[model samples]
Target: MPRKSLPALSRRMFLVASGIAAGALALPHSVLATEPEHTAISTLAFDGESLLAGGANLVRSDDGGQSWTELPAPGPILALATHPERPGLVLAGLASGGVALSEDGGRTWESRSDGLPEGEVDAVAVASRQPDMIYAAVQGDGLWKSENAGQSWSFAMDRPWLEETEHDLLTLASVDLATGMGGIWIYAGTEAGLTRVPDCFCRWQDVQPGNAMDALVSGDAPPSEAPLPAGEAVRALASAPSAPETLYSALPSGIWTSRDGGVVWSHLVDRPASAVAVHPSDAMQVVAVLDGTLQMSRDGGATWTALAAE
Candidate 1:
């Protein structure tokens, strides 16, 4: 299957991002397509017991990635996040604007963008420890949070302002690892780099060390810096709920995994990946979107098998 360009909203955001880092925005031609005949997948999530894939279409697989069944989706899905414990609770960030809540797995959906801004929702993540707590990264607007599932939302944080540009956030995730502060960490992948803030709503810090301003925030040391070269951004992020310390991030460089709660990272996959997901209960079973196709690795990333689309 040949990949195509993403929808209009994502393209527009990429154009804006190109102003700061033009090379990083040179997306391959096989990412997404709007035509129904051409299937396009950009994001993946584990719905506790099953795996959900979305972009131009939505599909669910109960038996890992061996088989799939198409599911209902409001529109082109930009991102997806499912509750770690709630079997059927899912959140989908739409390319159109706002988000949709699906409680009956992906079979049904309801609009849940009450307080969100009118722009594409780039990414969304639901807290594992607190299923009701959620985070969304809106395109033009910054990040938004919801305490009561997706009933409503409020501003949580602003996008990173670097090099005179407010970098657009491309992905978001809420990791359960304790931050020594009052809460876990909420991370966002932007055009600039990977940045995170303790749920305490304190200050945001880059995952890469050596920031003079970060020194004045607290004595707490920064998490292990990701090995991405300067100007590379994390394009997608996923962390295991059963093992909060385990994290997988997809970037233009490739896929990287962290076992010590983002303290130490090791490159796992060498090719660029658009999205990644770990089984909610089993961290070793992983799936990633490579060149707009689905690939699964049962023993972490030691090996991989491409899954045929149904």
Candidate 2:
């Protein structure tokens, strides 16, 4: 579902169902008092102490989801990823042809797009085992890599399949890091299909076709009113820190999980979510940010509770 077409539910209803209202109400007035009335909570990433969200602007919550403080960045953030080893290091992909890195949590940011082709940075992720290395999916430009943090970057792969389709790399995720290779496994979701890129090679192999890619490739025309196909545009990808092989993809229709990399997947959740994040410390505790609010699943996406709304 496009962020704009989400159903309008009352803030009270949204908060009550998500079980975040009670926690948010307990937060100090200073932190919860200055929310931007018009902001939409688009993407979410956690740094242990605070939940960082990127949307129309950036916002952070020290007290769970009860209260929030705006942390404006230079541009609209399309994707957000936290370094697995570095507690505060964060990479933000911008809607424009740019990328930003934050060393002090998200309090500050700096642009780092050297050598990257001109295009929107659709996705961003850091090596869970190697925090210094980062990867990005540049729309129309293919994949890029930054070996030394975000100071500099180089094209990692630009396969003919990616270039010929003229599709943007909308989502990217690192599958496993236990192997010696810094980025052993990668998944790239494009308008054409999901591309599975292993560490040994630079070319991407297209996975099975589904509505998720079709919707985005066909311009948001969901196959069904039931949120299945719409949830597969590869809006978000997350790998459980505790179970590296367990990967989750946030598609337009719903959430899908794969226990053995991207070879097979099963539906995890049916809600239309824009982004999903796993608790770095607990895989069972995950959060999904939708167009108007947030959802939490304690049992690994078996069920969901709404948190808040615009």
Candidate 3:
């Protein structure tokens, strides 16, 4: 049976839940802080070697999710992406504004937002096959692309708008597939819904268009199984390099899994999830943020172990 969807998040709750709260600090602090110092997490990334959790701050765990150590972050990180071939290369989208690049894992970072507007970068993604190609979704500036890594950027597309208000993009991932235009697709989880654009930087389209997967030579049909719940905002998206077709999405309703690329989906965790990450090589090893806390699952999503922030 399908799990029941949770209540919709209010505008204010959505912002905080997405990791853009006003009080989010940049400096590193203890993993587990007292009530007054507690920080809410908004995103997660498992780069095969280290597990990173970002939001009001940042923390990394080298031994899976067993223990965590805080790292100095540029600011409240709204999104994170890792390079497929490079172990320590990480790109971070900052809530404060701009993007940051970390070469020695998450230990240190340098500003790499050249050419990008000084606005909250809600989402960032690195092409797995072409690490130099980076994409960022700025709060109001829309999507920006950088072919020379994050060294500099150029406008690629506009932010999604409904009625007259522009919706924010919460997450992004570069999936490796034969997308006619190229062999990869840039997937974005927006306030409006899940959309993807060929790495060619063309117009974004819904994931369910009948001919959506026409370019796919695998003969897979466009996503038709269990569709995403209407009006539920997608908070985060994570895909494993070893299992390119598999995806994990964090939603106000729960964590949904897509095994056939985006062609089909099944609800896994039946609760509001703020962020999710899968091992870069192992699709079954996963980590997710539930109710502002972190949980880990070794046997896929069948069972979970709450990782204490301490």
For each candidate, what TM-score against the reference?
Answer: 0.82, 0.76, 0.83
lDDT of 3 by residue, 83-202 (tens): 769888888988778888877777767788778988888899998798888899988778999989877789998876643566777789888865426678788887666777777665
TM-score of 2: 0.76
lDDT of 2 by residue, 100-147 (tens): 887877776677777778776778988766788899878767788888
The deviation in Å at residue 60 for candidate 2 is: 1.1
Measured by TM-score, how close is model 1 to the native structure? 0.82
- Which residue pairs in candidate 1 collide? 3-30
Better of 1 and 2 by TM-score: 1
lDDT of 1 by residue, 252-290 (tens): 778888887665678888887878998888898888876
Candidate-wise lDDT, in order: 0.72, 0.64, 0.73
Cα error, candidate 3, residue 28 (Å): 9.7
Candidate numbers, best TM-score first, in rank order:
3, 1, 2
Residue-pair clashes per prediction, in order, are 1, 15, 0
Candidate 1 deviates by what RMSD? 8.4
lDDT, ranked from best to worst: 3, 1, 2
